[model samples]
Target chain A: MNFKMRQLFAVARHEFLNQFNSFSYWMMFVIPLIVVTALFKYVNLKFNFNNSNFINMVWGFSIPVLTFFFCLIYIGIIANSVARDKTSKLSEMLMSIVDAKEQINGKMLGIYLLLCFQIAFYTIFILILSKVMNNNFLFLFIGRVKIGLIVYSILALFVSLFMFLAITVQFSCFITDTSQISSATMPPMIFLLEFFSLSLLYNSVGFDGDNMIWIFYIICMWPPVGSTLTPSLIASGNISYLFAYSTLIIQIMIMYILYVKSIHVFKYGLLSNKKKNIFIEGFKFR
Target chain B: MIEFKNVSKSYDGFQAVNNLSFQLHKGEILSLIGQNGAGKSTTFHMLLDFIKPSSGNINRNNNLNIGYMPEERGLYLKESIKNQMLYFASLHGMKRVEALKKIKVWMEKLNVVGDIEDKVESLSKGNAQKVQLIACLMFNPDLLILDEPFSGLDPVNADLLIKAVLEAKKSGTMIIFSTHNMENVEKLSDYVVMLSHGKTVLKGTLNDIYNQFGRSKLDIVGYNNLQKFEGMNGIKNIDIINDNSAHITLNDVSFGKYIFDDVTKEGYLPVFNQHYPTLDEIFKTKVKQSE
Candidate 1:
């Protein structure tokens, strides 16, 4: 187990370095910065607001959009990471030495770490940017930064990222070309975006305090979609903290099940050259 | 040792490997020769447990370390040669320090001279292939499986690869690979398995197989009268090489001595030697026979 963990770390480190040095890495960070900065300035001038509520909204919305962007980048990286091996014929070499299970797990874990690093950077950048502009901006962006919200969001992000990692890993299995990876990943990214937008809209509609309980209940119990959105909703008083925590546990359980299922599909799919639908193929294993 | 006992595999409804049974012993290099869709790749897939056999069992000694180089070159084009090799080596349980050291040695030995940090996409096809080969061997697996390892290689690089394979064999690694090149098979294989239409058409030691096909040949010098042997009962085929020499094929070993005696009677002491069948000839004959 120690050896396995070490191997997984090595894989993650390699993956992070490879992406960090690439032109695409800079593009991912730069594009978001450009768009977010443009929006911040445009809204500040147009609204003439004293507080950075506009900037906070931009930052919050950017988090989910950033999630989509990172998910796409992650999909490309993971798919090509595996597909490049198949196309260049490196998988044959690697598979000769390592079994399928280790290869998939190592890669998924590596990508997860990379995602975490991106999130940390984004968080730090937002915090510092807010502080430099104005001290109160931090509270607006983090929304009171209570210990509970901080802890809950961290838990929520980890679970959400893990679920995404599993999906991307499974996507990598069936694809031999990197070009096809985006199509396989688009569905999950779209789902996350929908839930994110819906949750934000629901908060904007100004439901009464009593109505918040049912809304929170619905968000908490949902499977994969709920895992990411429920905690953010709870942190914002759109849902109860207790419901968010319980949902998190359920989400973890679902992630564990999906992880196991992904491994089975990964083992069979890696060796196969035949084209397949990702959802159908995954379901077949179950 | 690797054993496939009545192993079968199918993709969808199409059978790819059908009830194939074979044992690959340690230190032996086995060549699987067959045409496209003849179950060669399918067999390799089954060995790696990439696809479960529909029936029967494939039993290895244990979770023994094995190396594989598939026909479709698997490589990360965006990654550098050194980085790619290091990642693969790590998966095999090698520490970073050890993997790096071994990769350096292999790159040097394989004549991969250049910036190790250069992305694979920038390298020539041949150089990329060399890196791929190094990635497999760096782990020092007990069993090495290569699917057409020589495909797309120039003659010189192919020879170099063959030399490397031979050196690996000397270190007691059991090698199983498939190829269309008969010369390489003849040079490297102690045992050969021929597949046709998802079935094992031929399997045996190289010598044992060639010997079974029979040896027959004719040599002649200063003999223009090839018509004299045409009427002979033992002669299966005859062709005049030139005005002075003619080649003859005897129906059986018994006919060779009689043909020699007859040629001598004609006051022509011809030079004749029995020739063992070449792998190419045997492969064509067996495949045709199976069809």
Candidate 2:
């Protein structure tokens, strides 16, 4: 790697280790895994899941709840991770050594690596637990969900994470004080919650009507929200694989553009002390 | 070497730094002394490329290795001092083993009074500041900028820090530091730039600064007839501190010899001193002049 890449990785590694060693980061990572696992275990014990309905119920409930739980954890983690540097006044020192874009990218990469670890750890634990308990429902659920849909769902999850993390980092750069983090990151959290609510609504009520399907199509095109809704739409057979793929492409493009634009805000916001509108500051590319 | 040619920075309509120019060469320590908001931090920021000058040119190698300590001191409160220093050293491209060795040396050299494994929060305020300095110093940066490095440090710890800075200077690291303390500036600076309200009011060596004001202050003790100098030609003002002692201000340096001769006519006096103004006095006089 080149010098710039080395510096970027140094930042990423530092951030990762710092967060990895923190008590709160572990709370955010481990608690949700335990809570969701217990909830799943309860479902396993309470309901007789010998049919496709049970599979649908379990998968549907798990996706949104898991997403919401992890979202809450990630929101806190990312906010603190970004704000800690600025509030502690470490950002100014780091800024002298590392470029703003490098710092943002490094921080995101570090947290994202941790998120990947969480996902992998959670998946492995769930797999082992299901096998150990001889819970056929998990296998049944996996068998029933088409491979393509499973792939699309994972893709959509990652896309949404990337997009939302960019938004959070952008807003987080504006935080000069730790008290301002929740408020600084509120816009992205609001976006996530709104779509999270929609995911729940569509999953439970079933948007089977033509108009609602069109709305799902529209939601699937909008970045962030689209990333969350695309998988469910595909799983319901409301949208084809091609449309899902197109929306995925659209989401990636939007994420890329948004990330590039956020680089500017990231550069300026990290140094600014004033509280400014995220939209105004984030969109002002210079 | 780094050179700032006619640098000026303004925010909205308020100038933060105005028409500042200076040069720093290898092994030279330049001290920036100014009151709060005197643009000392702004000068450092411009050198670090954190901010751009609205007008002027700063010429230097773009990739010069630099270590900077901001005025508002900070460290990762939750991490061990060792961990944070190693992380920063790695950012500066130092190997882990090298950084560790350097950390041990710096901690001992600075009398940090804590274990390397101690979290920054566990250390006292002064020790934490020492850790911050260690982070900047361990990398052996080509150019080191310390803003208010002396602030919050006790006299003993300040001396330890001073020794460490002088060591860096001896190793040929070009250094610039800003402080309100004129004593440290006099001790460490090869050259000094004093700023007043974003303007360069005094810029030169300590001797040059003192020479500009001349030997205008005289202190005499155990001398009688202090009233003889009152309203005397070439005497600007006189303050009789005690029956036999007085503080005299001269209109010209040449008058020192005249006073010395007059006071010693009878015999040797216990105290009759003639000298240039102190850095503190020069600083005050310059601030007042700019205001």
Candidate 3:
């Protein structure tokens, strides 16, 4: 391979393989599955969502919740990985050898791939589980929903998680070390998810779409919020396909710009060990 | 050739590397000697283009492949040595086949006494340092920058490391290292650049620096009291190594003869050999003068 590809692959491979040595990676997948199984087992005792209406409602609600859930796990992982390199001084060594932009891009790509693979794995597991159980109506519920809208919504969720992961990686540039990782990931994560979490609750309540058309549209236009909001909005018919797509496209553009701009921040953060106000950091151009 | 022309780096009003100028030719081994925060690693960082200089320029022959071992060891300690080294090798644009071959060669050549698949944390401190050194060399970089490469190694491992470095130097790779160890600097450095608080304090070839001080180091042993040499003409400084041995530095060469003649008159002198100042003494004296 060429030099650029080699550099990218080197970083990407390291990021990808590093988790195989850690128990936390397995824990991340297992914890989510355990939570799902426990919640489902509890719900089985209390109520049954075998009916079409209940299955549809639960599906719609779970889409946004799952999007945020997986995205939050990924954000934590990506940020922790980025911050560890800096704290460990590996960034110093790695940056010296590889281009800073390539390092960040490679890591982002690697972690993003890991997320995709894990999600795919879990999806397949659930599918097989459904087949084995014979009583699982999840496949039936999915077949009844608008396939086009669900596909579009899943696409939105994917982009949303990608954007969130990008933002987390960006924040990691300012983090000095692992100790600052929580500060780097926490505020932005919780704050961004808070708005989405509330909106998700609102969407689940079966409110009249007419009351807050503008609010839904605005929320759908902003990312981290928009990614999840657009999908949930689609489920309830509060958003048009054109509007959702346009908002997502706009969010993608913004995320791309942030990524391009963040290359400078990546270089700046690794070189200086001094802690600074991260708010002012975003506006300053290197 | 790599040349630094009055390069200076400042971070938030604190200058990390001052207006330091040094040129290094290919195949030359230059050692940067300094204490903590002496801008040794900063200079290496500037060379790597991780951070730009606040002023001036560093010129290099285009697109040089560099392998750097930082003062702070930063490999994945929990990961297998093979995994981390392969990753580093590929980062330098080495193919997997070529990288693994070189990794094997270096592991054996550097006397790395562990399985390549072993986690780095499982290795002894000296063995880990050897693995790190191998990582620096396996890629066959055009320029190899090792910051405190021999810092944590035992004498045996240090010998192995020094041999590997010399072999690299012999093969025409320009090597630059930073260390507090004067003996290693004396052994490996073709030229030396001494940094104190981000500024180049003393620099030149081993011979040139020694000649600059004049050939005037008198090591006397088996003599308890040499009080007669105090405030004497031509005697510069006296450092007592122990009760029986003292290192006498003279400003004048003829004064050694005079002191020898005078001291021998009293008793039988065991050792009164005159030599050049060691790198350690020179370093201490230079650093002290600046302080």
Candidate 4:
């Protein structure tokens, strides 16, 4: 491998191993399995239901809820890792080797792989639980989870992660202490969560298909906002698969640009120890 | 070779390094001495490109690979000493195997005894410092900039560090460091730069600096009644401890023979040694003059 690639791999490996070494990794993976299993068992013991609509509701709501929970927990891990490095002043050492862009890319890749691993494990757990409970495996895996929805969900999840990463990177630049990173990161995240809830609520109320399509398009194209909203649009069948994919491609391109900008901010923030308004520092490029 | 020309760094309106310029030859060890906040750390930061100069230029002739040990030593407390050393070496462009080998050699040279797998936090302060110093030198960079490398070290460890620095200099590494200890500078520095209030007040070889200050002393122990030369016209200052012994600083070199004659007349003189000014004396005079 070349120098940049080698350095990138080293960073990614360090990040991955550090997370794996933590107690929280196992907790995140196993807690979801237990919760899903317990809920399935409780529902089976409490009622004998031949009602497909009830099952459909549970399935639809559960996937989004579970996905959101997993994503939230994982976001904390990624944010804390970034924050810890900044707080401990290790970011300066990393910057000495590669520029900001490579560092972010490597970190993002590590978190992405970690999320994929969690998602894969949860999917397998659900599949096995269905077989044991004699529920329809096809409905669990394929029927409720359309290929289009799955593709869009993955895309949306990545977009959201990149957006969070960007915001954290920018905030981390202005913060000298790790204690401030959580407060610094909360604003963008709260905005993203609000947008996510609104989109889900609109989908539940059954908005006009065309109006929903327009909303999804706008969200997918938005610079930092697109990360959370794009996938919900895809899952709700508001946008066609082709249109969602195309918009996602454009969103990724925009995220790349924003990623570069945020890395520049992060580079400066890591070295600065003085107190300043994070928002002001993020915009004042030097 | 390295050069910083008219470099000025400012944060807000306050200047950290104000119009600073200096040069380092290939093999000389330059000691940068200053009071706290006198801009020595800022100069080191500019040398490594950690912070940009507001206006001016710092030029390096080649691809400058620098090994920096910051005033606050950068090492993961939880990481094993071997692991941390290897990680740093790899970052400096060494392969893992080579880095490991170099770590072993350095650990042994420093007489560090412990399992290589022990965490850095488990090591004593002096041992941890040795590990940090080893990490800096493991890569054998062309330029080594150490900021207060001996701050928390005891005398023995400090001497060990001085020896290591001397060896690096012999192998042709341009070493620049900042320290508050003037004795270390006297022992190890070939050239010195004394800064006061963000300005270079004194810069030259150690011998040249002391020569320019022109205050010499003679210690006489056996002379009885040395009060005859106490207020001589040739003497700029005279300090007498008891009647037989005195230290005199001369205004002229010609007075050395005159003092010798006067001492000889006092009685059989047992000890009369001329003393050149030390770096400590020169530093005190220079800083006082700046004020």
Candidate 5:
């Protein structure tokens, strides 16, 4: 690999290890597994329900909720990590060795690797739980989940994660101190909470295709916001598979555009010491 | 070689560095001396490409390996010294084993009074600074930029840092450091750039800078004829410490020779020395003149 790529991965590995080695990160990783396992044990003992229908419903509800929780936890991680580099003043030294683009990308890549690990770890735990509990959760989940909705949700989930991560990183660049991190992360947090609310709302009250609300379609087609909504809408049978996939494509395109803009802000925000309005200054070309 | 050709940096209406020009060859140590906000850090920042000059050119190899220490010291306070050093080494593409070896050697050489596994927050202020220096030096960078490296260092620790820097210099690293400490500059620099309010007020070797000011200071002891110097034409000011000793400032360097005869006529003068102004004095004079 070339020097830039080497530096990028070095940073990524450093960031990943830094978080991975921390006690709190491991706590965050392990606690959820323990809680879910305990909850599963409780449900099995109380209801004695291990049927495929219950498993399918559990997954349908759990996917979006789990995603929301992942975004919530990792957003703080990404923002704090970025702000820590700046507040500690190590960003200047790193700037000499690696480009700002590399630093930002490396950090995001590092967090994504951790997210992957979390996902892999949870998947393994679920598989093991399924076997031990005598419930074929994966088989049932696969047999029942609509393939189109599955593809759309998988695609939307990843795209939404990247979009939220990109937005968090961009805002976190404006943070000069630990005190400013909460305020800097406010915008992305609001968006994430809104996306979560929309997902749960649509999942409960299915969209009506006959008496269509144009606004719901807009929400379902826009990126990040649309990421969960489109999959939920598709599952509700209010949107066609073609429309759902097309909206996924459109969300990807919007994400790319936002990625380009966020990268620009990422470069400027890392080095900026002045506490300017991110909404105004973030879009300004330096 | 790194060369700055008529470089200038301006922010909005303020000129942070104004038409600066200098060149640094391999194995050379150039000291940039200035007061706070005197553009020393700005010059370093431009060289490191942290900021760009608004005008002129800085010519250097695009791929030159550089190590930079900013004015504000920084380290991961919660990280082990070894971990952070390895992370920095990895950034420069240094092999892990080789970097570990260098870290051990540098820490010992700099007298860092802490274990490699010690978190940086556990180190004393001076030791932490040394660790920061080690991170810069261990990779053997081609161009090393240090800003105010001696600011808070005690004399002994400063001497240790000086020795380490000199070693780097002997190995042919082109070093550029900024400092408010004139003594360290005088001891370490092969070339000096003195700035005042973003303008280059003096630029040359220590000897050259001294020569420009001329040998206008005279020290004398056990001289009997203090009265003979009272009406001297070249005397700018004189303070007679006693009947046998005095310090004199000359209006012209040629006047040193003129006073030599009278001081030695006493037959056994213990001290008679005429010398150029000290770097500290020169620094004061130049800064005063610029202001």
Candidate 6:
């Protein structure tokens, strides 16, 4: 590999291993999943969705909620990593090797890898957990879930996760002190969390599956929350392919825009520690 | 070689470095000596392209690899020494096996107290500094910028670092460092750039600079009651270092022989050495004069 790519992956590899080395990172992965799974079992026990397409109901209900929760948790992790780099002056050291742009890009790639690993682990864990629990509900969930929708949802899920990770890192460059961290990183995540929480609740109410809630569907199509929300909707057959595909396309486009914008802001902010008008800067191509 | 010509930097209309120009030839060590905020850091920043020069330019080979140790230290305290060091070497494009081998060599040369696997946070301040120095030098950079490398080191550790720098210089690496310590500058710098208030007050080969400042000074030792030369014709100022020794600055370069003759007229001159001022003395007088 060339120096730039080598440096980028070295940073990414260090971060991936560094984060994985921490017990807390594992707790973040395991605790939420176990809790969510327990909650699923409780719902099954109470509502006894025996007649309701067990696999579809559980997955559609659980994946959206869990993805949003994980994203929220990860915002803190990714943002704090950036903040630590700035506060500890590690960014400057890395900057001497690679420009600010590659440093942030490398960090994004590392965290993205971690996120993918967590999601994949959760999938396998859930499959095994239901099998070990001998809960036939999840096994039935198979075959009923539209394979196409499941595939799309997974892709959408990763794209949405990338959107959050990129934005969180972008904001992290602006955070110089520990105190500014929450104010800088929290709002976007909380917005997604609130919207997704509401979306999950709205979906669970047995609204007629055939009737598309136009305005609600429009919100569901917007990234990055839509990336999280739309997939579950696809799994349960609530939204049409036409609107879902368009939303997915639009979400990817927005993600691409943010990816480019975040790289610029990250480079500028890391170097200057200046809080210039980001809105204007964001629109700038460079 | 790196040449910075008429380079300057400003923040909020306040000049941080002003019209500074100098060149470092291959294998030469240049020490930048100044008080805090005197543009040493700014100069290093410009060299690294961390901050742009507001005017003028710094010319160096485009492919010149630079290793820098910033005044604000860049280290991950929670990370192990081996991991972080290898990571930095990789960033500089050094192969992993090569970096690991170099790390061990540097660790031994630096006499680092802890093993490579130890976390940085667990190392003492001085040992941790050695680790940082290893990070900078292990990559074998073409140009090395060390910002206050001797700070916080005890005398022994300081000597160790001095050896490391000399070794780098031996291999033809251009080295630039900033420090308030005059002894190191005198010991290491082939050329010195002394800045006061962001402006270069004095810069040149040590001998040439002292020559330009003139050699009308004498250091005398073991002559009791040296106050006898207070009325000497060529004498400008006398600073008493102790009862037996004093530093004498003269009004003319040719007065050194006269002073020696006059001081010895009383008989038994234990030591009479006329020489250029010590770098410490020159630095003080120069900076004070500028102020």
Error of 6 at A96 (Å): 0.9
Consecutive 10-residue window with the lowest summed lDDT within model 3 chain A: A40-49
* Candidate with better DockQ, 1 vs 2: 2
Candidate 5 reaches a DockQ of 0.76
Candidate 3's clash total is 0
**Candidate 6 residue B150 C-alpha distance from true site, Å:** 0.8
Q: Write the per-residue lDDT of candidate 6 for residues B1-291, one digit (tens) a residue.
A: 799999999999999999999999999999999999899988998998877899998998978888888887757888899989988887888888999999999999999999889998899999988998998899888998999999999999999999999999999999999998998998899999999889999999988888986877888998887898776788889999999899899888798877777778788887888878778888888889989
Selected candidate, larger lDDT, 3 vs 5: 5
lDDT digits (tens) for residues A1-286 of candidate 3:
6788778877777787776556888887788777655544445532354564555566668887777777777788888787777776677777777888888878877777787778788778767766665445555666667777778877877777777776666677777756777766765677557856765775677557678777767766766677767776666656678878888888788767777767777777766667865545634665
The worst-scoring run of ten residues by lDDT in candidate 2 chain A lies at A44-53
Off by over 4 Å in 3: A20-22, A30-59, A171-181, A205-219, A271-286, B220-229, B238-246, B257-270
lDDT of each: 0.73, 0.82, 0.79, 0.73, 0.83, 0.80
Shift of residue A189 alpha carbon in model 1, Å: 2.3
Which ten contiguous residues of candidate 6 chain A have the minimum total lDDT?
A275-284
Please give the clash total of every predicted structure, in order: 12, 0, 0, 3, 0, 1
Across B1-291, the per-residue lDDT of candidate 4 in tens digits comes to 888898888889887777778789888899999888888988987787778899999998546667777775556777788766766675566899988988998888887767789987788888988887887788887888888888998998898899889888988999999999999998888888888877788888888887786647677787777777767888888788877787777878678888888768646777888878777777777788989
Query: Candidate 2, residues B74-174: lDDT per residue as tens digits?
Result: 98898888888888887888899999999999998988888999888899999999989998888888999999999999999999989999999999999
**Deviation in angstroms for A64 in model 3?**
0.7
**What is the iRMS for every candidate structure?**
2.5, 0.9, 1.6, 2.4, 1.0, 1.5
TM-score winner between candidates 1 and 3: 3
What TM-score quantifies how close candidate 3 is to the native fold? 0.87
How far residue A259's Cα lies from its native spot in candidate 3, in Å, is 1.9
**By DockQ, who's the top model here?**
5
Worst 10 residues of 4 chain B by lDDT: B84-93
**Candidate 1 vs 3: which has more lDDT:** 3
Per-residue lDDT of candidate 4, residues A86-189 (tens digit): 66556555555555767777777777777877778777877787889876543444554556566666667667667766766676567766677676667666
Quote model 1's TM-score.
0.86
In model 5 chain A, the worst 10-residue window by lDDT is A44-53
Question: CA shift at B22, candidate 4, in angstroms?
Answer: 2.9
